[model samples]
Target: MESTTADWVSETRFGKWFLSTETWYREVLSVALREMREIAGPSMPPIRRLLDVGCGQGRSFELLAERFRPREIVAVDIDPLMVRIARDTAGRCAVPVTVMQGSVKKLDLADGSVDAIVCHQLIHHCSQQAQVLSELFRVLAPGGMLLLGESCEEFIDTWSVRWFFRHPPGVQHSADEYVRMVRDAGFGVAPRDIRTSTPWWSLWEFGILRRYGLVRSPLPVTELLLLARKS
Candidate 1:
């Protein structure tokens, strides 16, 4: 089906519901954030000038602020409504964050300006995933990091979940394909893990893709947690 940007953003029940409630936002997204931090390591410099691509309602930014204490946080989304809601939600948080209404395929940021770029559950929504990855690579600094959390290719096997995501914007990739994409974008793979964290019977994948090569593993991973650094 042809999915417009509006249809993808406005029709997302989870995003709308997340913007409306604090509890659901905290409960559902916190696990991913915690795991990201654990993999990112505590000794890393406090993330400054961070960019969250496709940040719906800025929930992840809210969680990241409490743990990492970034100096500047920017959240971008293609939908104006999502950006508006994200700005409002960020306003309620302890730290200041900027929300922009823009597409990940074309971000409004200077080259090598951001220290970290995060695209959580957002890559799947892009029809031009490679273009988006290129843009992400372009805006990140040499030592910057890229964190991606996405649905696994295995998710399509389930009939119920498949129906919910049976749209053009919903694209799932296998672990090997994702790794190749990250490397092709000029980043090396780092430490990552793919495991089921949700209580639901559904399968999901989460990973941190970095800009540099720090750690590598041949272990089979369903949902990737990659950390790639720019070379």
Candidate 2:
């Protein structure tokens, strides 16, 4: 099915290639999952069916299975190439996975169909961020959880990222704004549910100066990881 909205940006060649890299799997994806799970705490929901939005190359599949052990997984991405490649990756996952090519602005799934969702590093590329969140809220079951991970405006607005990636212009948001956006979309985002950080990879210099103690000041939060639950 065709996406009802065209408010999405295609990943640049470098961005697409980066998604498949070991660095992405280890440093970015794995770290995000670990942190999100930590923030979710002991009350994290039982995920019978999980929806992974923007499941690039399906790298999160095995991690999701290991972390949540969901009975089934539904992975969606706007890129057909990623979708096709992700299908191959999905086949290797222990959990049953269905990878589909579609936009999160309008998921083809039924209302309240999923127990959990992983929207990792996806909002920065979409113009209709609110619409995407609303769609996610609609598809999620009541009491379901949404693990939302994002590179906040501080990181996405940088020259290196701008030059190497293709994002919808003027749509980036700060960490606080991101939390508010999810809350405004009908999810419950308690203060304790939020996590913000400036990871080494998010730094323009890859945190070299910070590692050497040349940069002592705390940096603006470049990462936003949260667990918002539908009520």
Candidate 3:
């Protein structure tokens, strides 16, 4: 048996707590929705078409619908199983959504087609993060926004994470490095566009220290959210 970087985004992993967990969804969805709104601000243009990279089982379709309300939401995943689930989930949404199975590194979509792109928790899985970043930038229309959320190497190196997940070590990046890559990909990375966080899940990696008052504790840089725009 052998494992590759693609295994990280495989169906078996998606069936696990990584994509199926209720708490994880709540935590990510809360921040993603809020940050996206804040990034777009008041004078934002109407989002007609949106591309959700690594949509994985369509977990984000409902959230995207409620927040951005794109007239057509394109949900994409590397796994076929997830793509099927995404299509089913999108079919159920009030918003017209399309689900496709493809890699962000080389998307089949036309250039500058999507109004916005939501790429979350996906960059680390890419063997070629720059290619994916470039694809994201290419697909976004001028003045379109890109909401990118990812866990840095610091978080991935934690004992709990190292035990449960498999990642390509070479692709991992720190919060600063991740932001730099996005910037180098031609995105407008402002100071305000970059944000780093230690989520509650990361605070107590195993949930062992959360209830104790003895340790208000070592909060690792588990997450980084960057809301960039294509100009």
Candidate 4:
């Protein structure tokens, strides 16, 4: 339960529990990975080692293994509680899994240590977003891919989400800004490599009213998905 000195916000209790649900795996994690795979197309290099930054509950382990078929997975979460649960999840995977509790702002990884990085739905929780991105760029091998996914400011500012989840307030970004941030961090992200989605789950009222066909706001881009490669 102890927090790190880094400018990171640990997930709320509801947020943490939701991460273990089938809904998260199916709707969020799997979808993002699949989209990034499509975005990468033939450009994605052979991935031998992958680093899963902000790997909550290790939910992405099996999917990362099955999709990328990496030789090893190194997963880290800032929260110690999530790390313990993720360690259990890691053991269930077919691939070699290493779970650690650490902040992404200052990763323990050596420079150019990983062939790929899966950093999904993590940046908004970080106030030190640029520093975190810098570390991601640092540990990734040249030509390695970064599968980055995030909820844009439009989605993160929704009342339902604001009530249930925790995030660094001032650092929330729009889809374009998120794209620019990654580009500024030294990753090579082209326009074709970026994807914007407004999944039903990201709808206002957490899609409850939308599911009932009661209300509709001007649908803005709520999610940003991209495949950035180290140059």
The model with the greatest TM-score is 2
lDDT of 3 by residue, 104-128 (tens): 8888899999999998788887778
- For TM-score, candidate 1 versus 3, the one ahead is 3
lDDT by residue for model 4 (1-231), tens: 745354877677888889989999998999998887788686556788999999999989998898888999999888988999999999999999999888898889899999999999999989988888999999999989899999999989988899999887888999999988898999999888888989988875666787677876667999999889898
What RMSD value applies to candidate 3? Answer: 2.6
Model 2 ranges with Cα > 4 A deviation: 1-5, 213-217
Question: Estimated TM-score per prediction?
Answer: 0.79, 0.95, 0.89, 0.94
The model with the greater lDDT, 1 or 3, is: 3
- Greater lDDT among 1 and 2 belongs to 2
Cα displacement (Å) at residue 35, model 1: 0.8
User: Which pairs in model 2 have colliding backbones?
Assistant: none
Q: Give the range where candidate 4 is weakest over 10 consecutive residues by summed lDDT.
A: 1-10
**Overall local distance difference test of candidate 1:** 0.68
lDDT of 1 at 75: 87
Which of the two candidates, 3 or 4, achieves a greater TM-score against the reference?
4
Candidate 3 contains a number of clashing pairs equal to 0
lDDT tens per residue, model 2, 1-231: 222246767777888899989999999999999888888787666789999999989999999999887999999999888898999999999999999988889999999999999999998888989999999999999999999999988999999999998888899999999998999999999898888888889999898988899888778899999999998
Winner by lDDT: 2
| Model 3 stretches with alpha carbons more than 4 Å out | 1-17, 204-218
